[model samples]
Target chain A: MKTTELESYLAERRQLVQEALARNLPPPDTYPPVVHQAMHYSLFAGGKRLRPILVLAAGEAVGSQPEPLLPAACAVEFIHTYSLIHDDLPAMDNDDYRRGRPTCHKVYGEAIALLAGDALLTLAFEVLSRIPATIPPERILRATRELAASAGSQGLIGGQVVDMEAEGQPVTLEKVNYIHNHKTGSLIRACLRLGGILGGAGEEQLALLTRYGEALGLAFQITDDILDITGDFSQTGKQGGVDAARGKATYPACLGVEASRQKAGELCAEAGALARALGPAAEPLELLAGFVLRRQG
Target chain B: MKTTELESYLAERRQLVQEALARNLPPPDTYPPVVHQAMHYSLFAGGKRLRPILVLAAGEAVGSQPEPLLPAACAVEFIHTYSLIHDDLPAMDNDDYRRGRPTCHKVYGEAIALLAGDALLTLAFEVLSRIPATIPPERILRATRELAASAGSQGLIGGQVVDMEAEGQPVTLEKVNYIHNHKTGSLIRACLRLGGILGGAGEEQLALLTRYGEALGLAFQITDDILDITGDFSQTGKQGGVDAARGKATYPACLGVEASRQKAGELCAEAGALARALGPAAEPLELLAGFVLRRQG
Candidate 1:
């Protein structure tokens, strides 16, 4: 797919995800409106909806329609958004901005922001369990397990813990890989696997998607680290050099910008090749791999 | 059942839940050990395993064996523990101690405590989804949904939000009841409902359990409030009068100690009557309600 075609595909998918999210989430004005409002404030704060899009794309690659997969798609986004909200807490990354706006804790007080994050995380499972009755209960259960495992201590939170602990410490490739794989890669990998599981992919297809996900997730995080140093606030929606300021570990810090970019390129190529093995239905996954490599933010 | 029999039943059920929790959770020595340690630290701190016991007793009320319901039992306690960890965070309640020891955040710092709470919450869903194959997938799915909904925005978190906002403000009986029903009542209600759903209870049995849960939850919280004001730290396991120190709303604050005691007694009586309606298998639940009313802690 050409860049423009891929952009349009992403835009269309993003809109579908936005609609599903809006539908599934309680309105901002819902009772005890502050937390709901806080939830919406960050949720609608210009996210790329990358995780949900991956869910839809991977499902399509497994020969399933996007409509039936919308709940799983929204569910992944909810988990992603909650992670961001909590990560931005003063006790965590202490960021004032996310996606070019004030962070959730900055907009809503820390207490509400904390509860909002908790609510969103809980809501993800609620949304998954309620995935349209068209999907078998067994599949939904598997999807829920996949999502929980990836987001739990051994996955996303595990990575965050290691990254937080590794700050200002010695940087090593092994440590960086562990941090990146757990923090960002785990959920990203789970998105594809969740899609495949829910879409009824065979074991071989699921394994192929897992390989594609691992490569894509690592590539995506490497680019993220590189962008943290080289990209401006306008492009990244975050302050440039903040990681360096904190003496935080990153790919650019560990491997240099040029090496990091090359590494990301290789991973993306590998991901694209793996996606191709899933047949023509996975064409968009191949394109998405390229997009993740090239994205400025 | 006699009080001694109920004590034995409670002890036996608590043992089952503790064993399941120890078996299911990643050990403290697991990779990225601090967070796992923080999780274990708070989880093993002595407290009455009220929620998990409710799960087992409610399941037994409907003729299901405790062995099959261990996962669901442990899952509720995990949720309860995660809530305590987060609620003790500096950003939230900022407590220095819980169950007689320093809080998780005090021990592990704010960041790991936050992540540990997140990990535990995620692990709850993981445990639920992985409920033994003996329980049908559909029932497991339903149990997952019930747990999430009770813990999510409209239930547990909603109450927390409202309670946080209502702090140091004018107290009203209506608002206090709302907080109790939500913050404590919702999960307690979910515990019974989860047991009924998992145990294949008929509609009438489930309704009785729900009603029993509602009364027991409110009664338990009311007793908790009275204990906070009148009991010593040895029994309650924290600083006494801390609720008044924070100017938090409570049943005793709203209704006065005498009225609050009367109200709790009424609720327990109602709960006991509902459990009695569930037939001989519900004898334990009936006894448990009286225990809630009479316990000092």
Candidate 2:
């Protein structure tokens, strides 16, 4: 896919994901109006929407409409948004602002923000349970399980604990890999796997997509670490130069910029190869993998 | 049941529930030692363990051991604990201590406390998913549905949002009931309903238990409101007069002390009648219901 084609695909998928997210969310009056507002705050805070897009791209790679998978996709982003909100709490990163506005805990008060994060986390599962009629109940269960396992203790939470313990300390490559794989990578892999599973991809195709997603996830994180050093903070939204200030252990901290850059290229190549193995159906995913490697942020 | 027998039963159930909770919690060191330590700090923090004990009593009332119901009991409490941790954040309630120890956010820092809460919430489902032995998958799914629903928007989260919005204002009696019912009442009801469902009690049996639970839960909050006015701070583990200090709304605040006391008796009678309908099997539960109404905290 060419650059313009890729842009159009991403834009279309982003819109679909957003609409699905809005639709899947608990109706405003179903909850008090304030709860809905707080939930929509971080959710629609407007980042790259890369996570949900990955779900669509991977689903398309396996001959799915992406609509059936929309619940899981939105759910993955909800988890992502929650982690971001909690991560920015004064007790956590102590950041006053995020995405150019006040962070959830900052604006809502620590209590409501905490409740908001809890609300969103549970809401993710609630959203997943609302998968459309076309999707099989078995497939919904499969997708939900993938999400739960990926985001739970053995995955993301475990990784986060490791990262916190390693802060301000020297981190090994093994430790960095462990943290990234769980903290960010597991959920990303879940996004693709959910798409593939719900899209009716066979086991072999699922395995291939899993490989593609894992590699793509690593490449994405490597790019993030690299961006933390060299990317424009104005564009990144997060104050980029703080990794060293907080003594956070990042890929760039563990391996210099040159090595981190090499690792990303290597991961991109691996992901690209897996996506290409799916033949014609995988072009959009191929473009996405490439985008992960080359993105400025 | 007399006071001696009731105390013995409550004590026995508390021990059983505590043992089950300790056993079900993920053994520490599955990740870095610190993560496990952080999680254990609050998980093991002492409280009345009322919720789980209630699950046992409700379960046993329907001729079930309540042992099979412990996971659901623990899950509800995990949700409760997660709410407390988040509620105590600097942006939230900002309390430094909980149950005489530093709050999770206070002891572990905001980031870890946030993650700890997240981890606990996630583990609740993980614990539920693993039944001790063969059980109907439908029951498991039903239990999960009860727990997930109770913990999120339709239940605790809804109450929390309203409470946050109404912190200083003189919230109306209707709104206060709405808040308490969702914030705390929903989970309490869930505990009994969960116990009934998990114990494989019949639908008729479950309905009675549900009524019993709803009445007891309302009375539980009313008792809490009463305690805030009259109980000794040392005995209650809260600073007496803090509720008025914060201008937080309570039943007594709106209904006046005499009416509040009468309401408690009314709720208690309703709960006991439900338990009495179960006859001899519900002896402990009948006693427990009346006891809940009289408690100062």
Candidate 3:
């Protein structure tokens, strides 16, 4: 895909996510005023919406539309938001800034922030369940299963456990890989799995997507670490170099900046190759892999 | 129905919950040792497994099988367990004990505790999606919809948000009700609603279940408050009276013990009446409501 084609594809996903989340929830009028406002607050706060985009892109990869996957997509964003809030808790990471705004727990108070995370997660399931009835029940079940696995101990939770455990400790490459692979990699896998499941990706297609997911997941984390060190504060939204300060087990922390950069390049190429393995169907997914590595954010 | 019949019925539902949770999770062997154990520890801790039982009973009220609703029932339990872990966190309710054992975050550390909560919440969806392919897509979607609504900002999350805000305050009756209603009640309500949806409850049956849920929920809270003051520490297992000490709102605090007891009696009766409307199928639900009130733990 040309650079121009990739940009448009990315833009299409961005629009799809924004539009879906914008109206994805029921009308605010139905809820208690305060709770409704709080829900909108964290969800609407601007971010890349990477998870939802993954859902859409994955769905499109298998010749699916954005509509069937919207609820699950919105749900992915909810889980991501919930994690940010909990991570920001006074007892946890403790930094105040996030996504160019005060963190959810910071702005909402720790208790509210905690509840917000809980609410966001619940909202995610709610969204998944509300998918269009025309979609196969089996498909909906598959998507929810992928998402649930992504969210659970074997996936994100397992990853987070290792991540926090590694803080202030010397993180071995094994530990670092476990943290990134589980914490971030699992969900990336879920995104592709969701796309594949929703899109009807066959065994071969799924196998390719799985490889793409592995490569992209690592590349995504490596890029995040690089950005933490090199990106401007205004652009990254989250506080900078704080990972090193907190002694977080970031990729750059273990590999050093130059090595991390090389690793990220290698991972991106591997991801692109995996996407290419899907032939033309995965062009957008392949282009996405490059964008994940090269994007300024 | 006679009390013996009720006991038999309750026993059957309890058995159902055990099976439901059993089939849905990863084989403990497959899990990362610690992660797997923690998930099982919280999951199997010996309570009545009341939420799943309620779900099963609710399904029975409309002829739904116990097996089909297992995923959702387990999901409800997951949400419930997540709340308990967070409630026990140092930054929140801060109890060192639960069910006569060290609390999750206590044994696992706060970080793992948080992830455990996240993992449990995520698993709820996984369980929901794991339902067999034979079940209609519409039924699965509807079941999930009920799950999400009860779990989200409009429900449990909202109640928790308010509960956090209201702690250590001079709370009014209305405020206390809101906190209690949402914190525990929303989920309890969802348990039945999901069951109803799964069981094919008609609009009328659903409405009746809603009423049953509301009464049972309030009664459940009132009983929790009463237990905090009245139950023995050895019996309850969890550290009791923390609510009163924290000046957290409670029915007894608002209504005094006698009135609270009377109110629980009234609510349980109301729940029973709603179940009675279901004829024979409602008997288990009625007994379930009574079980909520009369049990010491």
TM-score of chain A for the candidates in order shown: 0.99, 0.96, 0.95
Q: DockQ of candidates 1 onward, in order?
A: 0.87, 0.40, 0.66
Model 1, which residues run further than 4 Å from truth? none
Clashing pairs in 3: A137-B137
- Please tell me which predicted candidate would have the highest lDDT against the true structure: 1
Best prediction by DockQ: 1
lDDT, candidate 2, at A146: 75
True contacts kept of each: 0.83, 0.39, 0.82
Which ranges in model 3 have alpha carbons more than 4 Å from their true place? A25-39, A168-170, A279-281, B26-31, B238-241
Off by over 4 Å in 2: A1-8, A27-31, A56-65, A132-146, A196-206, A278-283, B1-8, B56-65, B132-139, B200-206, B278-283
Ranking by lDDT: 1, 3, 2
lDDT of 2 by residue, A131-202 (tens): 676876666656766787787777887787787778898878998999899988998898889889888889
**All candidates' lDDT scores?**
0.93, 0.80, 0.80
Tens digit per residue, CA lDDT, model 1, A1-297 = 677888899999999999999999999998789999999998998889999999999999999999889989998899999999999999999999887898999989898999999999999999899888888888998899999999999899999999998999989999999999999999999999999999999999999999999999999999999888888888789988888888787898899999999999999999999999999999999999999998998
Candidate order by DockQ, decreasing, is 1, 3, 2
Please write out the lDDT profile of model 2 over residues B215-284, one tens digit for every residue: 8888888888888789875677666666677777789888987899899899889888899997788887
lDDT tens readout by residue for model 3, B98-215: 8899888778777667767777777887777777665676887888888777777777877766787788889799998888888788888888888888778899999999889989
Question: 1 or 2, which is superior by TM-score?
Answer: 1
For candidate 3, the docking band is: medium
Clashes of 3: 1
